[model samples]
Target: MSGTVLVTSRSFGSGGLDLERRISDAGFHVVRAGAAHELDELGPVLGDAVGWIAGTGPVTERHLSLAPHLRVVARYGVGYDKVDVDAAARRGIVVTNTPGANTSAVAEHTVALLLAALRGIPAADRRVRRGDWSAWYTREVSALTVGVVGLGRIGRSVIDRLAGFGPRVLGADPWVPADDPLFDRLERSDADAFATECDVVTLHAPGGQTVVDERWLAASDRPVLLVNTARADLIDEAAVAAALRRGRVLAYAADTLATENHGEGASPLLADDLADRVIVTPHLAAQTREGVDGMGGMATENLLAVLSGEPPVNPVPVP
Candidate 1:
């Protein structure tokens, strides 16, 4: 467990490389690679590695089998969906992720998206840039009802931040207890019901398929403003596009997309339609300076702990 560490990272700005240097200074040989596109190339390089600081790479069972000396795989961010946790667990290699490190940043970004959508910030900015500045229009934040999906750490932070906005915040989390103070006015209902009732709907749900489908979009009683700072798969892309076309959704803002690594000619969500009403940030909700340092520190600590035969701080379930 004292060998060199392989860092299979996605494309990060120069700042990420600086962080890797810091890790190297901490007495671990860091073998840095851009991406995991060449698993064949990675196999030999990572053969003797004891720890891995991973990014959004496809670390499958086959990839795990290549590194018999690997004891830990520490993901950069909260989502470890791209990594094969079960495979790592089977090989007794602990998989860890930085969970709460980026919660505040994400929560703030979620609020930004919500405010941008509700107050027409993007539209107004575009209009002003084009010499079309008119007098400020009247808008009321208190008048809008905001609904939060998945009341986890980020969700709770969102709720806490939104408390001062004067909007009634409703939540829909099946896991939350009925008597919990967070669920004061929150309801344990379906996504459709939540969609139908709220003027602004912010998503904090995990990545998967069909969390927000055509049916949920169709069930909306009014033109809803959708903000998803969470995973892209929480909302169906095609359904959201259709919703935008028909005015079912007034506006939409997202920090993540269904396909992040969309190769040449790939259709990303809201890429074709460059409407001012929609705000799409390249998956950077948790890319703040503090977030990066915290995530890197936590991930490094987790890798160190696992390699030292201790439990990881945020262990992902394997098989």
Candidate 2:
């Protein structure tokens, strides 16, 4: 418990160097390496390490077998789909994530994408650059009803921001209590029901292909606006593109896509017809300076807590 803590980072920017420094200053030896190579290298030092701050590396049972001294794993962000939690739990390793650390940053970015899609910001910018400055306003946020798919930390924050914009907010999360003050009204119905009732549907759920295929889009009553800043697999990209082409969806702004980490090089939703109607951003909802610093600090704190033989601030359940 008094030795080095291996930190496997996956293509983190130079800001990660500062996080390494903070870990070192906290009186623990740090072993920093890129995730691509670290999975192979972890076997060598796993016996000496007390904790690990993992990025998007594959922490399989094979890698876990080497870490007899490992106590906890602190993920850099909220998403833990990349890590094998069941394997870690079987070995008594506690996995933790920095949940609310990047809530405001991601929520703000989600709203920004929503507004950008609704107001045609990208198209308008391109038009202005092409020397066309005709005064035009298509749709307003106030004129639309927003359906929030998940009412978690980021979802609630987005709902709070949307409240100021005067848009009717409908939430669709069974995990949240019906009497919660965060939502104007909770829709116990499925995603299709929420999609049919709202003009704009924003996603804030964790990873998974929850809303798959064109059935959800086809079920909507109008050309809905889809905003996803959470995970790419929540919606079907091909189905969404088809909906956009058929005029069933007015626009879509996604910061994440199912093919993002698939190494496919191009998005399935980036078709020529859907390009102008879509706003696709890399998975950068938590890339703000403030969010980065907060995530780094919280990750370091979680690792340090495990090293000190205390419960982590955000421990991932052993299941």
Candidate 3:
């Protein structure tokens, strides 16, 4: 109960083990903050916290000003868009993130969504629930040409799973070398070519602003199914909505949305009319039991490493 560590990730102890014991065993008093995303309440608890494990919230310069003892900000997941890395480094605070920790969780969910969309699972379930016995069908999953936008950990995982389903999997990634040995099986295709050639396009690309817009999917030779589990910023929602309306993009399945919690109502794709066309999860793709525990352990280990005068296992790259 000497130095304080604040755990703001909501699912930190969701594995049902003694999460507090793990940190306390390392010689720090555990302080619980609701979730890093809830920044308003963070001000009251930041003053004494020497370490913090964050969730999907912004760790801004303004917030850091209040944490006089804060030594490290450990992001609970891979995405670091929410944290201000430059400012943290300026104050000599180490920033760390748990990457590849949720790979399986997200990859499994992405495939599940692909099946749901192609098989018309959600839409059909609604029809059956409302007492309609008539069966409706759309497309078969195994027959569709699939395109994967990123060939990284989660992206590669998705392709590996797709191989058993009997569809041709095309990979589109500018970051990876064309002759990289890692992509022995995945046929290489550029994003533009993949867009028109792929019947089902799934985005596992890295996070950034407007990576996919109307232009990306507009040239499709056929109606397409769009799946996104990486980050909402990767796709232009308004354009996707327009495509859904026009039937160029048949459906959209995603774990992450424009707003993680749609308290203000659904993002553009979550509209009532589009509910049948758009399937959105509450960002739980990586909320699986295994994913939660793995990410929590990684984030905690990073925090303890920084506090113990050791370099973090996975320090975020300085921008």
lDDT of 1 by residue, 1-319 (tens): 3478887655232344366665566667878775543686687867888888887656788888889898888898887877888888888889899899889989999998888877888878888999997856635768888888888899999988988878877888777777888666455554567767888888887665456788888778898889999877788877887788788888889997666653435433555564766888877788787777778778888888887778878888765
Off by over 4 Å in 3: 261-265
TM-scores, all candidates, are 0.88, 0.87, 0.94
> What is the alpha-carbon lDDT for the whole of candidate 3?
0.85
- Per-residue lDDT tens digits for candidate 2, residues 1-319, read 3677887755232454477766677777887766643445667778777788887555778778888988888888877876789999988898889888789999999999998998898988988999999767678788888888887889889988887888877887878776776544444445667767889999888775566357787678888889999877788887888888889989999887666544566776887767678998876788887787777778888888877888889988765
Taken over the whole model, the C-alpha lDDT of each candidate is 0.78, 0.78, 0.85
Angstrom error at residue 213, model 3: 1.1
lDDT of 3 by residue, 1-319 (tens): 3588888787887985666788899888888876534557778778888998988767899889889889999999988887999999998899999999999999999999999988778998999999987876677667889999888899999988998988988988899998897568878987788767889888888776565687875777778898998889889998999888888888899888776742555588877888888898877889988899888888988988899899999999999
Clashing pairs in 3: none
Total colliding residue pairs, candidate 1: 0
